[model samples]
Target: MTVTVESRPTGHPGYSQTLPREPESAAIARKLVRTALAAWYLEDLVEDAETVITELVSNAVDHARLESIRVVVTRPTEKLVRFGVVDRSRNVPYMRTDSNGDNTRGRGLLLVDALTDRWGTDRYRWGKQVWGEMKCD
Candidate 1:
């Protein structure tokens, strides 16, 4: 809910976007992230991070059926970037691998889980925060 545009650069490019939790919101958030961090150290990782953010936001939009999503990004250092998407969903997202090649829509988190250094979900009073971390040294 807060977007702090601080000057202290710790490789931390943070932005919080509250938007109607829809498919388009994911794309919006991705663009916002690229703009916010275009001057930071992880410019190369922006695309990957955007993809992850899109997947997380899209998941919430499609399955959670929520009204809004808030995204936050924090980079502790130049080598790591942690990001999360907050949504009004109580159900924790899980990865479902399709072995029979019959499922096409269940691989978002799987990609996130595979690409990130770590990823998890935390509970909030009205919803949950799904987060993941990427490294770019």
Candidate 2:
């Protein structure tokens, strides 16, 4: 649970850390995000960011079928923040084609889709990265 918060010369702060594939990692990730947002003066986007982070991290921990996961939060630009969770599972995540009424297992992407300006997956030689980006005030 050692998280590093670093600031860039461009004035955008960044945070990075790795967490074990435990159920509690999601919550810990959220806390780390809140801290980063406060320092980066992006508190207005906390709620939306919180939801997005939870879904992204949980997917990596529970579904990616990996032992541990990596989390990165960075501001590629001042007005936007991008967060990604990298997992060893190469299976890219896709939203359910049909909303099975009351099915609680597959709605993570829906929240992500509604919350972020854009979200997608990228495949790497070892695994995949699930990322979401949103604009800040």
Number of the top candidate by lDDT? 2
- Show the lowest summed lDDT stretch of 10 residues, model 2: 5-14
How well does candidate 2 score on lDDT at residue 33?
A: 81
- Candidate 2: which stretches are off by over 4 Å? 1-13
**Candidate with best TM-score:** 2
TM-score of 1: 0.82
C-alpha root-mean-square deviation, each candidate: 6.7, 6.9
lDDT (10s digit) by residue, model 1, range 3-107: 986453655346677888778888788887786567564587787888888888878888775577888777767666777888887888888766638767778
lDDT of 2 by residue, 1-137 (tens): 99996752223448878899877998888988887788787788889998899999988977776689988788888777887898999898998768799878878999999999999998998999899999874
Deviation from native of the Cα of residue 78 in model 1, angstroms: 4.4
